[model samples]
Target: MKILFMLRDPFYEAYPTFIEAARELGEVETLYPDRGIEKAEIIKEIANTDILVVAKVKIDKEVIDAGARLKYIIKYGAGYDNIDIDYAYEKGIAVTNSPGQNAESVADNVFGLMLATSRNITKKDHEMKSNHWELSVGHEIYMKKIGIIGFGAIGKAVAKRAMGFSMEAIAYGHYLDPLAAKELNVRFVTLEELLTTSDYIIISTSLTEKNKGLINQNTIRLMKRSAYIINVSRGGLINEVDLMEALNQKQIKGAGLDVFSAEPPQNALPLLDNVVATPHIGGATYEALVRMADVTMTNIKRYLAGEELLYRVYPQEVRK
Candidate 1:
């Protein structure tokens, strides 16, 4: 395994012992955070890679084809949209991801963002620091109706956390079973109801073909004028252009976004004062880093032993 890590930055002391073990198995190299490299350079660097590992970088068909000896791709988190999965499948390259590894960490970030926007915490802190102490009344989140999209591990965790705040949590999914909804302690609702009813709506779903740009002008109109949105899922979930127009028009209250349609957005997201945006770091905690690495190691051991890889992504239908 000639492992190549296409990571933005070092994760959790670089997971020292894991690196040592992988080094024993085969050669390992990383294209780290600070250095700037073009796609052509990236293609050149991965020419001999047998196992390509990544966190945030996009691995298109060009990069996959450039890796003449590529065998496997291990995404550090649950989402695999950054990779051209069909092309890699055609090339016979195995694609895997670390699901549920970062669930708790991401849930924490969702709450953090939620509180920040709802209470105007960041704005208040800025005002106090600048010696301008005008009282700015913020909304209380207690007993508020919260709607969570995509009732997966992260959504369930968000629901559990919402209980501590005394908030009512409802969830919406396309094919949610009644028993599963009962177990999660969330009442199932339609997408339209969730959007219209919730005081705070959290996007915790993955980006699928049907749901990309799901939160558009018409859906935004369905929301209450004072309602807020918290997105910790994929960037493509919301339409940035429509969101910007709504923000300027005061159609909705505000947003706390951890992801964007285009990373380092080339649009009006940064210009809005009401929007609190982070660099897509919903699950960048040290715990998440270690857990994902552990899961990846399990897959590597399976690959070496001629066993089925856990959290395999490509072919999407094969699950055991």
Candidate 2:
């Protein structure tokens, strides 16, 4: 058996334990692709591989076809949109992801971004470092309304955290579980209501075809001028150009973005004084990395032993 790990730079160093365990099962090879992996190179490396472990690399039909021995594709973290799920399914390649493994890490990041943006934490720190003492009025999240865009594991975790701050939590998602919301003390609301009413709007949903660029000019217009947007999920969910314009016009207070429409965005949104941006590190904590690695390894072992796989991603789920 052969296993290929297509882990990108930085991430390649995050899973030493997983790599050590995989070696006990098969011949393992790990590649640290620069920003994006070359398709031809991936095809060549994956040709004889029985399983492929991917993070941030796009696994499309051409590469899938080249993986003659491929039987499984494992996503290192929660988001599997980077992989071509439909194509992999068509090729009889079972795809699985480590959901909830990074929920706490990402949920913590949600507040980290929220507090930093709301309180001008980063801005004040920069100013202080420059030998200038200035005080800026910052918004308080206490007793404020927070609208979560997705009601998934990460979203639920965020809602749980909101309770500690005495904030009201409301969520909007394609799939809503009333019981879950009731337990978390979150109310389900329409996208418009979430935008208009929330003091802090959080995008914690998956990026899908139906909702791509969901946060555009029209949606931004529905939000309160005092409101702020914080996205810890995929960048494609928000239209960068529209967000930049809204931020520039002060139509909205500001934004906290960990993910961009493009990784290392070519735009000036991150450069804006009101915006606080990070390089997609919502799930980069040591604990989360270890949890994700453990899940990935368990699924691989389950697949090898003919046991039921965990977190198996279905085509219909992604299509919706």
Candidate 3:
């Protein structure tokens, strides 16, 4: 059996996990494309693949068609939106993800962004380095309202951390569980209510067609002018141009974004006094990567052994 490993980059730190998994399964062929490979190239490489592991690489219908022997696909992280689910299903391929593998790290990053934005930590740090800092007013998180979009693992983790700061937490999601909300001491609210009332808004939702461009100008207009928006979620969740306009016109107080609609935007967008940008490091922590790799390898091993994968997506769908 041959397994094609398509990674966005070479994760040398996690190579041992892959090597071990390969020894237990079959041959492991690896490819690291600095730039995303085109569909034709993907099809060419997937012709003999038995199992495919992908990270941030598009696996559309054309590529799936070329995988005559492909049985399964495992994503390195929680999100699998990059893959064409309908096409994978049609090809009878099982897809799996390592969800909750980096929830703690991502949640921590979300909180860090919230604190930095609310307290103006980044701004003051820049000022001090420029020799312009005297004393700057910073906001306290205590007794503040925090709204979390997407009440998934990471969202729950963020809410749990907010408890330490004595902040009230509210959340919105399609899969809102009343029992879970009660247990977490989080109020369930509509997206609009959360946007309007939250002093700090943290987005942890996975991207989908419905959620793309979720944080548009209309949504931004509903938020408190002094409120700060934090996105540790997928970049597609926010409309870049609309967000830029909001920040430029002070529609919302500020934004701390880890992901952008187009990663590494070609033209520099204005970073206002209140804005902070990060290069999508929500799950890039060393500890998180190791944990994720372990989980991913375990899932792959199970699939190879003809056992049900722990995090399988679209497992029951009948395929062509």
TM-score of each: 0.94, 0.96, 0.91
Please write out the lDDT profile of model 3 over residues 179-289, one tens digit for every residue. Answer: 867887899999999999999999999898878999998999899998888998888898888888888888888888888777665434436677777877788877887
Least well predicted 10-residue stretch by lDDT in candidate 3? 311-320
Candidate 2 vs 3: which has more lDDT: 2
Models sorted by lDDT, best on top: 2, 1, 3
Best by lDDT: 2
lDDT (Cα atoms) of all candidates against the true structure: 0.86, 0.91, 0.82
- Cα displacement (angstroms), candidate 3, residue 210, comes to 1.8
Candidate 1 has an lDDT of: 0.86
lDDT of 2 by residue, 73-146 (tens): 99999999998888888778899999999999999999999999999999999999999999899989999999
**Over the stretch 1-320, how does candidate 1's per-residue lDDT look in tens digits?**
68887776657355767777778778888776446668887798899988888887889988998999999999988988889888898899999999888899989998888888878888888899999888776788888999999888798889888888888889998657567567656898899999999999999998988899999999999999999989999889998899899988989989999999887788878568788888888888888888988898888888878899997785545432
Question: Model 2, clash count?
Answer: 0
Better of 1 and 2 by TM-score: 2
